[model samples]
Target: MRKIMTNKTSKYILLLICSMSLLSCEKFLDKQPNDMLNLDQVFSIRLETERYLANVYSYIPDPLVCNGVNYTPLSDEADWVFNWPHQQINTGNWSPVNTPYDIWSKYYKGIRAASTFINRVSECKECDELNPGITVQYREEARVLRAFYYFLLIRQYGPVTILPDVPLAIDAPLSEMQLPRNSYDECVDFIVSELDKAQQVLPDKQSNTREYGRTSAGMARALKARVLLYAASPLWNGNTDYADFKNKDGKQLVNQVYDQNKWRKAAEAAKSVIDKMPEGLYKKNGTDGKFDPFLSYQYVFLDRWNTEVIWARPMTGDAVRWERCSAPRQINGYIGLGPSQQLVDEYEMENGMSPFTAASTTANPVINPASGYTETGFSTTATKFTKAGIHNMYVGREPRFYATVGFNGMDWVYKGADGKTIIRVELFSTGKDGYNGSNDHSTTGYTTVKYVHPESDVRNGRHVLKSWIFFRLAEFYLNYAEALNEYDPQNPDIYKYINLIRERGGIPSLPEGLNQDQIRERIRHERRIELALEEHRFWDVKRWKIAEQTDAAPIYGMNVTTGTSFSDQNFYKRKITESRTFQKKHFLWPVPQYEIERNTELVQNPEW
Candidate 1:
C-alpha cells in the first residue's frame, strides 16, 4: 500500500450534513467560508474521489491483525493465551447483545461510500474532463467493492439488506428507510451480477504503479469464486432449518431446494480465475531446477504483489505489533500466537500421506506412522537439508510444515548482527520458549513461524513486513477442485487442480482410485494446511457445516518436560490446552441486538 495507495492522513470520514440557505437576503453572518469539502469538491477531482474509495478499501480487514483470540484462536487452527472474547465465541458463550466480531456497521459504511461514489462520480464534470475513461473504471471498482462489502455482511450475518444507490435520506419517514433484509439467494444473485458487470469494465491488471493494490478484473473474479463457493456450500445450500424464514413480502430467506448446478457454477468461476488469469502459485526456482515449496509458501506473504497474489493489503506499521506478539519467547517475543497440535497433525508427510494414525500420544497424534514420523524425542542426527538438528516430531514432514511450524529442537533461521544463522528451537517447559509462566510462553509449545520473516529482530524490535494476500492463485485452484469434486467427482480437472496445489506444496499429487468423498476431505485438508491462519479456517469449517465436529474437538498442545535423556525429561507430552464448544446455531453469527432494536423491519437469523 505504501508504493502508491495514499492513506488520507486525517480524512477519517465523510459526514452527511445538509443545509438550506433560502431567503436570507438581510442576514449577514460569518460563515468562516466553510472550508469543509463537500461532495461536489470531492467528485470534481479524480484523486479525491479515489480517496473516498481508498477509505472503502481500508474497510477490507487485514488478516494479520489477530485481536484477542480473534483469528487463529477462534478456529481450531491454533491457541494463544486464550482471550476471553475468543473463549466466549469458541465455547458458544456469545450472543447478539454481546457480539464478538460485529462488522455490520463497518461494512455498511463501505457500501455507503461505494454507493455514493458510483452514484455521484458520473455527475462530476471535471473528473471526466481530466481522467477521460478512467472514471468509468473507478465507478466499476466502487460497484465491485460495494458488492464485496455486501458479501462480507451476508457471510456472517446470513443475509443483509442490499442498500440501493442512495441510502434513504435521514429526514425521510422510517417506513421509507427501514428496509427488510433480502433473501440469501437474492444477495448471492446481486453479488454475482455486480461482479459480472465489474468484470466487463475492470482492467485485467491495474497497469500503473499507483494502482498496485487497486481492484482489478482478476479480483472481481476471485471474489466471485469465493461468493459462489459459499453459495454452493451446505450452509447456504437448501438448509431446511430456515424453511419457515422469510422477508416481509413472504419471500423465503434461505433457498428451499438444493441446486446441483451451484457447484458447477462455482467450479467455472474458480476455473476462470485460474485458466484466464496470469496468476499462479508463487514459485522460487532452485539452483537444481525445481520449485522450493517452503520458500515459495513463506515468501507468498513476504513478497509484495508477487505472481500468485490476486489481491493484497499492506500491513503498514501494524506489522510490528504482529511480529512482537507472534514471535517466540526466546527472541523476546510473546510467542502469543501458537499453532495447535491439531493443526500440526493435519499436515501430511512429505510423501503426501496423512499421519492420523501414527505412533504418537493420543492427545496429539501424528499421522502416517509408516514414514517413521515420531514425537519420540530430539533427532539423533542433523538433517542434511537444514544442516541443523531437528526433533523427530519436526522431521519427515512436508516443506509447508517446516515453513509454518517452529517446534522444539527445530532449526530457527534468524538474522542477527552478523548474518543469517541457524539455531535449534528449545520449547521445553523450562526451556527458552517453554511453558513456565504464560506471559510470553507458547501455550501450545509451538510458534507460528509462517509469517515471521527471517530478518525480523524481535529483541531489537525490527520487523520484516510485506503485503497480506486476500486471494491467491492456489486458492482458486483449490476452490475449483473442491467444487468440482462435489459436482463432477469423476472430472479429471478435480484431481488436476488439487494436485497443482499439492505439487506446489512439495506433496505428491493424487494418483487415482480416490472417490468423491475422499477427494472432498482431501480438498478440505489441503485448504486447512495451505491456507492456515489466513482467516479462512474459521469461516471454512463453519461454511462446510463441520464446525460442530471440528471446532468442538479440544484444542491440544505439547506439555514439554525436559529430563535426563531425549526420551526422559525432554519427552514432550500432549496436553489438552482447552476444551471448545460448537453448536448448529453457532454456524451463523447472530445479528447485533442493537441493529434489530434500531430497525423493526430487520429479521434476526434463526435461534437468535
Candidate 2:
C-alpha cells in the first residue's frame, strides 16, 4: 500500500532530491555546477539585490559543538587564547596533523559569493523603472562586499587568487583556472578603488533605510582607513614577518615600511568617519540606558541594522537557527569559546590605568584575596587594576570593565533560578568554581559578559542579544589615535581621541608628558582589552609582527592560593586556583595541506 504524504516528510524529500541533483551534476562535470539562478531572475528588482546582500551577512560559518571542534578557528576561544585546553596550542608541539586554523576556504567562498553578485548586477540593465541610482547603489554595495572579501583574504593568507567576476561557463574546470595571486599593493588598490566608488554611490548611514544594514559610505571609508593602517603596519611594510611576499598573480613584491603618509591618510579617513558618525554612549542614566550599551554592543552580532554597527553579517532567521547548533547545550552551555587570561589582565583598573603599574596615589586597590596584601606583587601604578588586597569583583569599577567582565566574587544571576528577580551567582571565588581558579573559564579567571544575556532579560531565550561590535565608534576613535600618534606623536588630537575613549569607558586620562612609546603601548593595551574576544587579537598580533613576542611563548596568569574556610569548620583551610600557558609557533596558522597538495604554487607556512 502507498503511504500518504506528511508536510515534514514531503519537504525532506524535496530537499533530498535537490541534494541528489547537486551531487549527480557534480559527478557529471569535472567542475562545480552553478545554481540555476539567471541574470534576469537575480536582478529583476531591488528586492533581489537586497536578498542577495542578505546572503553576505548570513554567511558566517557555523559548526556543531562537539569536543570543541568548531569552525573559523579565529572565532574559537581556544584558538584565540592560550586558555584551558587551548593552552596546548602554539607549543612547538602542534604539528600538521593537529593543525588548528584553516580559514582559507570559508573566506574564499565569501569572496566568490560577493564576486557573483557584483558580476551579475553590473551586467544587468533591469533597472528601467527602478531608480537608476538604486541600481548603481546596489552595484556599488556588491563591489564593496567583493572588496571586503578580498581584504579578508589579504589579511588571512597574505596573497590570494582574486576572482573578481564569475567564470563565463558554469562547469569551468580547475585546471583551466590557473589564476595567480594579486600583489598586496594591487589588491589594496583594487579594494580602495571599489570603496571609493562605493562611497560615491552608497548612501550615508543616516539616509539609507531601504538599504539599511547594507554597507554605507561611512563603512566604506572606515574599512578603507583600516586597510590603509594595515598596509602601513610593520608586518606588510618592509617587515620580516612577510619576508617572501607575493601577489595574487604570483609576482614577488618588495617590503614596504610604516609610511608616514599612509598613517596620515588612515588618520584622515578615520577622522572623517568620527567627525560625521553619530555620538551615542550609554551613561549611568539609571534604568533607560542602564544596559543599553550592552544591548548596542551585542547588536553588532544580533541586530541587522544597528546604527552602532558599521558593518556586520545580519545572521538571523535560518542563519541563526543553524547557528544554534554551535551554542552550548541548554543543560549547561559549553565553555568551548572562553576568553584568555591575557585579555582579562588587559582590562584597565577603574581609574583607566593598568592594575599592574598604575599610580598608587590616584588608583583604587581591590584586594587580591589570595595575596592578603594591598600592593605587593601587583602594579598599583599601572592602568586598570586595583591594589592587591581589595575584592577583585567589586562593583562600580571602570564602566567598560564592568561592561566586559563577570568576575567570580560578583553577583552573577542566571535566568529563572529561585524565581528571584535575579538569581545571583558568585563570579569570583576562593574555590574551584569561583571566578578565578583552575576551573575558571578565562585564563585570567575572568569570564566574559560582553555577549551574555543577563538573567532578568526574558527575550533571546536567555541567550545574549548583544551585537558583536564588528566595527564601532570606540574602535574607530582608537584607530585614528593610533595612526595619528604614530605619525605626529606631539598632536593633542591623539590625546583628545584617546582620552575620549577612556572617559567613555570610565577611566582616567593619560598623564601629561607621556612619551610616544608609552602612549603607543597604552593604545595597544586599550585595543587588546576593549576589543577582546571579538576575533581581533589574531590579526592584530600578526600585523604588529609581535607574534614572535606575544605568540612566542605560552602566556600565564600569576599563581595564587586563596584561603577558604568551610562554614562551622575550623579544622582545615583549603586552596583553590587555575592556570594556563602556551608556546610561540602557534602564531602563524598551518596552511591547509589539502590546498597546498592540490596547488604546487602554494607553499605551507613555516613550522605549520
Candidate 1 per-residue lDDT, tens place, 1-608, comes to 11122234111111110001111211211221133788788777655665565555656666566552246688888887746477778777888999887888889888987888888878666545654565677688788879888998888888789887686666988778788998898899999999998888887665553345667888999999999999999989988878877876787899979999999999999989998765567888666787788788878878777888887765545556666777766667777778888888888878877766635444745456566677665565666344344557767788898778877766676777677766665677666666664567677778887777888777676666566678888888899999998898889988888888888888898868987887887888899999987888988987788888888888888774442322443346678777888877787888899999888888888787
TM-score of 1: 0.90
Best by lDDT: 1
Which residue ranges in model 2 land beyond 4 Å of their true spot?
A: 1-53, 60-99, 122-133, 164-176, 206-211, 245-250, 254-258, 278-284, 287-307, 315-337, 358-396, 414-420, 426-444, 455-464, 555-587, 603-608
lDDT of 2: 0.51
How much RMSD separates candidate 1 from the native structure? 7.1
**Model 1 pairs whose backbones collide:** 355-366, 355-367, 355-368, 356-367, 561-569, 562-569, 563-569, 563-570
TM-score of 2: 0.73
Q: How many residue pairs clash in each candidate?
A: 8, 58
- In order of appearance, the predictions have TM-scores of 0.90, 0.73
Query: What lDDT tens digits, residue by residue, belong to model 2 across residues 145-253?
Result: 6777678767765656656366446577766554565656777778888888788766566343322345667778888888988877776666554555553454565
CA lDDT, every prediction? 0.74, 0.51
